[model samples]
Target: MTLVPPVTAAFTLEQSCFGKLRHSIRAFAGSFRPPQALSLRTAAHPSTSSVIVGFEASTWLRSPINALHSIPGRHVTIAFRTEVSDDGELSAWDVQSRKGQYDKVLNALWEMDLRELRVLRIDGLRWWGDQKQLFQERAYPFPPTQDDEAPLFARAWNVEVLILTARSDVSLLEALTELPAARNKLLFPRLHTIAMEWPRHESVSRSIVVDLFQKRHAAGLPVRTFQVLRKGGQDERWEDLLGFTQVVVHDSASE
Candidate 1:
């Protein structure tokens, strides 16, 4: 579905006593604004239509339930970003903190009302830390294992598009390999599109990419579109890739 440009609204106060009062009111109202990175849109008409919500930088800090409650729609696409430090080095504490924050958001998502959400796009996740240590320490933020049944974003039956963008191929591999043992039973049953992004220069072998989709298919996910996005490169031949009927490669100069 085509997404409309995000709509923004603003209010200004005049330079007068009443304006000062209005300014105060606005300030008070602003305090109640949705948490950072959360954006909601309601339909202009009364018809039962879809809505779109966007969460940008550092979305894991806030709960999305409250913002979602105010909107009504049959189909919703939640676009969000997870930001990690881009610095060259990271402490163990930094990794742990990132994991904790991500888990918090994951748990919140699992508990949220997803009766209308149809798509979830993690537009981008920046990880500048030690990749090996990150995965070794914690599970990927979605589809909590049977050990933790409550944080199940992957189990949401309504979700169709699951787009995950990572900073590197290792990060993507870590996410896929860290899935629970009973992954097939705990997978995205209704997911139709699985898109992943990473740098082109990252040393991701074709086998790794192929194996990821193979695992998804083995898990009973009827994913129809398999997309790969890289910073710069011609589309690679993915005809040999199993699982998805369509494989798309995208190159972005500015990625």
Candidate 2:
């Protein structure tokens, strides 16, 4: 289910009847949790257009795909966060380490046409090599294409906005904030707005942030707007970003 499902949906979390009968038989790192309740909630609410899951998210990956499938006309916001350790390690929720255990789940992500998505958001989740390899493998029989190496959202050409919430040591900065290797290798080609919710003051360097914008401008693919989200009222920080694009501040308290 997506987009603020009904209150009744919470009841299924406790004792879903589906859990009693439909438990996954496959061996998991620890134990498997039945995901049937996810499908049931979606079935109950037909108007759902957004889906966000946190705990036991891997078990629920199939629910959205089962509904949307290969259709690209309808757009939805899908956010799922699995458990990742503070030291770049994965918890039992990690699906990629299981080999072919979740091939269908990975396929569900690849099969969906990502071009229709308008906003792509990334937090502190460490994708390791999984995200990169996803596109790399798709380039089979074509020598390595740009899609094979570009960051995940870079391939979704239609995306207009990118939101990032990252820490200093997160791999996302290493993967996304860096300048493109080639002059023609522009990232987030159609993105006009970039929002950074600085989780900590020391999270990312201002020079690194400004350099990315400057590089993009030189390549003729400049982002038009940059937003910084702060906890309380608006505060003056990284104002130098104004040199490259219109700077906007968001007061998270009021929101």
Candidate 3:
């Protein structure tokens, strides 16, 4: 009703629009405030309390393992997987490359401080290339070599749980039996659980399992649980023969 200058009228309208816009923005932002109960729930969850670091062979070269040192956690498990072939066969050149990769990973682990490492699991393709098939074709036994760095790394870290799974022409049983007596007696001294996954077609005798446990005991390794997991059916007969209270057979299909 009062006469006002044209500029004053326009400025008042602009200021009113800006004020409304700011108020709306503030209300929208406030709506997103997280509930206090959600924060408490996240703090209490078990999975949230632990940290896991995983590595794949393809990406391992690009990433630095030392970055794990900065993560905060009371427990940590390092899981690594290596794939050797596009078709499950390693060529002559591939063998050298694979060995180099393995050595690099071993060296990294050895150099790192792993006081919080609770478990280590590695799954990979056969390391032996076509040598096993070649030996069988020529009617000769394939000689297996023990991994020197693996035991030393496990012993140094004092890993509590260890799991190894690889599909190769070489039998895991044979490799375990072939472990040098000197190293076998000292490897995995703090290991509480050991799990091995052999190929589905492989057949391991009950005596081999018993011998493995006996060797571990002799080595002063405090192993309390031993598990052999395979992908097929299970036979309860081994339970009676194993005689060890900690031995258990798991069928991977069911679990």
lDDT of 2 by residue, 104-173 (tens): 2332333233444455444323234443433223423222445453433444556566555432122343
lDDT of each: 0.40, 0.40, 0.35
TM-score of every candidate relative to the true structure: 0.46, 0.50, 0.42
Candidate 3, TM-score vs. the true structure?
0.42
Clashes of each: 0, 2, 0
Model 3 per-residue lDDT at 218: 57
Task: Give one digit per residue, the lDDT tens place, for model 1 in 168-253.
Answer: 24344434434533344433466566556543445655667677667666666546776666545554677767445477666654
Candidate 1 stretches with Cα past 4 Å from truth are: 1-111, 123-150, 166-184, 198-202, 218-220, 242-244, 251-255
Instruction: Please provide, for model 3 over 1-255, each residue's C-alpha lDDT reduced to its tens digit, 9 standing for 90 to 100.
Output: 322233212111111111223232222112332111000000101111111332211222122121112221221232223335687677988766655443333323222334444554433222342221211111112222353223323233345555543322223333333343334444345666656653344455445656666666554544677666654464545453243437656665544
Look at candidate 3 and tell me the lDDT of residue 77: 31
Worst 10 residues of 3 by lDDT: 35-44
Every candidate's CA RMSD: 13.3, 12.2, 21.7
